[model samples]
Target: MKNALLIIDMQQGLFHGPHIPYAASSVLSNIRLLIKKARSSGTPLFFARHTGPDGSPFSEQSPLTQLIPELDVNVEQDSIFIKKYPNCFRDTVLLQQLKLRNIDQLVIAGMKTEICVDTTCRAAFDAGFKVVLVSDAHTTIDNPALTADNIVRHHNQTLAGPFVSLVSTEEWVA
Candidate 1:
């Protein structure tokens, strides 16, 4: 199975503000590790950036839509797909790009586990790609309905069997 790494919405806007994702530091670190591993293993990396309406953090004119500075994104080497919805495939060329490269397995990680991360994971599965979700490399902010920790846990459990194979950053990297 050919492998590719799909990083969803690890944008500056999502990391800042009052509602920082749970375990932001560790999640970022894990994602960095994944990136390193993918580079070393010759796995292609695809980054998804979410766009929002004007006045929102992810607006086209907002710097928040930019990828986090901590991530070493090479415009020349990495593939970036701009998305306007929670499901990265909704209006993006991500699937086409992956197909062009003959990628059949996707290792997905990034921000907002309950939203973009979750939606993209399922979409990738429905699109017939074998998906591996980096369990510790994705996160979300706490909501009134559930703590961020619980949200991550819930999505991981729910999506594992049906939508993805669950792996850790260490496992994937090693």
Candidate 2:
């Protein structure tokens, strides 16, 4: 089972707004750990950046679309996809890239638990790829009705149910 790592929507825009997810700072260490493991294991790492419509702050040319500095992303070694929709596969070359690499499994990590993260996981599953959602590697902002931790826990426990496998960064590295 050849696998690749998908780091989705960990953009600068997400770091400086009210739209930012809660406790995002807390997950950086876990994400960094996953990145290191993926690199050491020779797993291909792909990054997804959200691009809004023309003139929007997060548009293709905007700095806001850049990967967050916490990850210290190296664009030269990583594949990058600029997506307009929540699903990384939508209108993007993500699927083609995976297919070209013959990747059958995906190790996913990133932000906005209820949106981009969930969307990509479901789409990947639907595309016939096995998905591993690194529980500690993804996070979201706090909502009025529920804490950020609870929101992340809920999705980690139940998003797309059996279609996706939920595991921690440690387990993945192990």
- Candidate that scores best on TM-score: 1
For candidate 2, lDDT tens digit of each residue in 20-131? Answer: 5666666778888888998999899999999888898878999888888878788899898899999999999999999999999999988778899999999999999999
The CA lDDT at 35 in model 2 is: 88
What local lDDT score does residue 120 receive in model 2, on the 0 to 100 scale? 92
Which regions in candidate 1 have their CA more than 4 angstroms from the true location? 54-57
- Local distance difference test scores for all models: 0.92, 0.87
Residue 61 miss distance in model 2 (angstroms): 1.4
Candidate 1, overall lDDT?
0.92
